[model samples]
Target: MKLKFDGFILALLFFIVLAYFFPQLHRWENGEVLAWITSIGVSLIFFFYGLKLSFKQIKEGLSNWRLHVFVQLATFLLFPLLVLPFYPLISSEIQHDFWLSFFFLAALPSTVSSSVVMVSIARGNVPAAIFNASISGLIGVVITPLWMQLFVDFGQIEVLGDVYWGLVKEILIPVILGLLIQPLLGKWAARYGKPLSLFDRSIILLIVYGSFAESFDSGVFETVGVKYMVMVLVVVIILFVVIYALIYLLSKSVFKFNRADTITALFCGSKKSLTHGSVFGKFLFVNSSSAGLYFLPLMLFHAFQILVVTIIAQRYNKSFEEAEK
Candidate 1:
């Protein structure tokens, strides 16, 4: 019997420790140099995504309008709405920080790599997962700030607009170029799935390192008490359960998707991207005093989602085994 550990989770922990102990590696006003590198890496990851996915797969995934729409709605609309009612909990300054983090978690995009990998592990519709996860980030680029604007004033139209333009140049351009060249390089990219996965996870690892380094250097966790931490953890776990249950029910009863696609919708719809959360936090709270706390909920949710999704994926995998037997 063998146990599978999530290397990314371990790496995130390592990065947190590295940030706390040696902040110099990833500490900068915006983690400026690494941010540029991460941007380029993100673009390359999408480029490879384009290269590997056949145009037919892309077209089919996009045209699955029902699945795509349902998943996106759950991600952008449903998740935030679920968290909104708890706004009253932010009465105190401490609680206000938690709320900001929670709302940020709610507004983040679906994580691309883990969502797709978990969908694959659960033997779900991989193409659909890829499409939903990829598009989720693009949607978040627009929707996340809008959600934040409703709750708190960003106070700078120029900064907000700059984030959008950055996404267009850095993320959208690479994906489009990759799609354009997919016919030429798709087979080659497909052949190297393992390496491409490493590339993807590495980008995430760097982002985690950078985000936490910024947080730690600023002493973001100094005011956070054990009680506050525990409460936030509980809230995050409950949030995951509610979202997962809702997505599962909708997939079966409402959407009537098959087993594979149900898994895709369940996983993708429930995930919140730490990558985009980190990026948004850097810009949204760049000069704010509590900038560090902004990503705390997102960090917590990232860990919680990985644990729950892995368990669910394993259960699904076991069921498949029994069916085969």
Candidate 2:
């Protein structure tokens, strides 16, 4: 018999279960310490990311106006609008939590690494993919919160006033610091990639555990159950397919984008970053007890999109190879 552990997702579930049954384990008065630790972890993750980024590549990608415009609009505008109409359909608090999860997925920016990887695999515009994927994270910092504020009241959030400073302290400043010091440390950071990855994933898991622990302690997860989980999974899968198809058609049939640009547009536009989702959640849901619920759709979308997109990119790659042969 063979058993496989899917690492982060499994770890996420374990921590969630642990927190649920043994909430005391994480409810230490040191909750503030954990928050600060998680904050520092987030900053470090973005910092190292900044270290590895290349501005020269981003500059070259700016020339493609059509590609940039469509990808950005798809990410920021089109994605969220896809879920807005469903507002009427959600009635219960559990239902609303799921809706917020869906909205959270849409509101997020394109992921950096996976977006670029898939585009490269599909023989896409790699430079533009890199550009859009990189910029999307930065842009989401401002746009996602503003979008959330459209529905949720700001007065209720205590950490929001610290929002800008928190963003700077936790995200932008560290990213900038890493960028500035990249010439010196980028190589070292890149060299020990495995450990860095282990470090990154560990912090993310901590954040997940901490967030969900809080939710569990406060009795937030009790309202939602396995049926809602199934609903979310289905919704996430549908969201990925619909968005991917819409972008593909618009890129090829309407915009007349060439093969490479189409691949870039498709991959970059269709995906959401869970990294940014977790980091952004810390700030956005600080005063709200439903913070963990907001992460559910992100976790769902992240897993589903990777599974679906990998198959699609592989098929796309195969087509190009067969044509050449």
Candidate 3:
């Protein structure tokens, strides 16, 4: 079987390059326009997210409580705990920011589309994957912030208040509105899932462009040497490998899950969402001048997870075919 490159990953890299070359465009009227665009885009993305989520499917998925428990624990608890041990290594403000990036990646929710797609490809429990993936974002809205709050000094209580308020206004409210109307428009949203997804990606791309553009303009990359970048890449790979292996062992040996459940656990439990990472960064690091640095590990992890999971999914596919033969 041949390996296929994901188009969105390529597009992600392209926007970073574009931002490096044309950081000026993002500064139109001191970035007010781009900020407005991203702010609105974040709300709409979550709105459509709620609009498409099938509560019936979620209800069906709840029967597998063990699978749901494992996936959610791996996402919210295990990932952050693994990274928390490294916090003592921070010696300076820069190192603190870098460490925070890794923690942020660990704290994020799993990707809904990619997780479900990979599980389906690997012949896993697709409904369970869908349920876990869909619910992870809502869980993250509360959990991710609480995790960050433990470490992040959001200036004052007022600033922290503003962050939660922004989250509610931008993410929660829109999602609630969408859910309220989901009965009326859920089918319509599901019908145009592809286009809505495209719209979602477009908003993310715009956020990426604007973010990197600001960082580039502020000379953030000048401080980050190639050695540091290479280190980040290596650490990202290690993080993925460790989490993947741990989940695999737990699902198979401890939980005694079947092949389908094992695959769902591995894929959903190990994945992280760049979508939530992008939107959450806008709020979490709202005061930071070099906010793009925070997203760097997330973007890297996003690409790496997609590439690695696709290969694993294809191998599982091949194995299933051979067993049937």
The Cα error of candidate 3 at residue 55, in Å, is: 2.0
Q: Point out where model 2 deviates above 4 Å.
A: 1-6, 156-160
TM-score of 1: 0.87
lDDT, residue 5, model 1 = 70
lDDT assessment of candidate 2? 0.82
* Candidate 1 runs further than 4 Å off: 1-3, 26-31, 157-160
lDDT of 1: 0.80
Those runs of model 3 whose alpha carbons end farther than 4 Å from true positions after fitting are 156-160
Task: Report lDDT (CA) for all predictions.
Answer: 0.80, 0.82, 0.90
Candidate 2 RMSD to the correct structure: 2.7
Q: Once model 1 is optimally superposed onto the true structure by TM-score, how far is the C-alpha of residue 218 displaced, in angstroms?
A: 2.6
What tens digits encode model 3's per-residue C-alpha lDDT throughout 31-101? 88888999998999999988977668879999999999999999999999999999999898889878999
Error of 3 at 124 (Å): 0.4
Measured against the true structure, the TM-scores of the candidates, in listed sequence, are: 0.87, 0.92, 0.95
Residue 84 C-alpha lDDT in model 3: 97
Error of 1 at 108 (Å): 1.8
What does each candidate score in C-alpha RMSD?
2.7, 2.7, 1.6
